[model samples]
Target: MTEQDPQIVYVVDDDAAMRDSIAELVDSVGMRAETYPSAQAFLDVCKPRHPCCLVLDVRMPGMSGLTLLERLQTQGAPIPVILLTSHGDVPMAVDSMKGGAFDFVQKPYREQALLDCIQAALSLDRDRQNQRETGHRLDQCVSTLTSRERDVFDQMLAGSTSKEIARALDISPRTAEVHRRNVLRKFKVHSTKALIALFAPAPAATQRAS
Candidate 1:
């Protein structure tokens, strides 16, 4: 399914009634809900990875809510989190915000407030996916440069000596200098690191000097 498909709002709370209530609340509004008793359980089967949000309780037995958030952040899990904490755990909510969680709501929150936060989280996740797609596309475009230019680019990114590159390519050092400049100009990067970093996750170099 596309990113615009119904998002899986994984609500993980050790409290069975609370989890069921949340699932019902979201389902009432025609959204998908997946309930998990623990953080590890959610991580196991949360898939078809489009857009997703997590509503995690603050105090779970195995892994606390904030601990789950940290794990997700470290793993680069793209799903935004809206943590749920008890009144005494408000400090944990603040920490969650600092760790890139979309929002955290204290329990007994109004139903509409939770809904609004979920909407915002889904929108933000969609935006992040779009940016990643655009960046990947730009990286692909960089792969279309000529073979000589590609060599120059890789070397420049590695901070290679222009003289060394010229010797390797059997081209004049002055000529290699021109290629180095061309690589920078093509990628619109002032430095070799920028050029290489751009293509790091993209398509393999085209190497087509045609």
Candidate 2:
């Protein structure tokens, strides 16, 4: 899907009334909704690129909701899941959470409560997708660096001054400074701190270097 496409709320419930009601609730908030009569219907069209989450019913005719969640876990990127079940199904809901369900709601839930949960799930999915995209971009940027440039980049991340880097790399201080500038330009960061922030969750050694 295009980057500008609306995030989808996928509703999977064998009960037609429940599916339509959930679809209506999702649509009220301006998000797109795709309803399925069973878990298999959802599995058939769940694409990796879709920014969506599952509003799954705990009990269904053939493949149950938990089964669907387990199957999806092995397929590709994990989709946020919110289980809908009756009050008596509380134990199953707890079990579903351990299996990676985002949240669960009891039957007779307020429309607003369900809507809020769905919105939260959609936001979580969006953030996850954004992080993946950012990581891909970072890899692409790293790929453009030459071996010498890469070495200089690592040294800079290690917090070496130009003079020190020159000694370490057997290059002149002037050359080290040039490489530093190139590294900054390539990373699109104005300063070392900004670079470090962009490369957050850096190694302990890298943090010490910074």
TM-score of each: 0.67, 0.89
Candidates' RMSD to native = 9.7, 5.9
Q: Please list the C-alpha lDDT of all candidates, in the order they appear.
A: 0.78, 0.81
Worst lDDT run of 10 residues, candidate 2, spans 201-210
Error of 2 at 140 (Å): 0.6
Query: In TM-score terms, which candidate is top?
Result: 2
What is the C-alpha lDDT profile of model 2 across 1-210, one tens digit per residue? 246868888889999998999888888878899899999988887664457888899999999998998888877557888888898888888877877788888887789888888777877777677777778888887898888889888887777888988999999999988988888898898886776677786332100000
Candidate 1 structure lDDT: 0.78
lDDT of 1 by residue, 103-170 (tens): 77878878998898887777776666766877876777568678888877767777787898898888
In model 2, how large is the Cα lDDT of residue 42? 81
For model 2, the local distance difference test gives 0.81
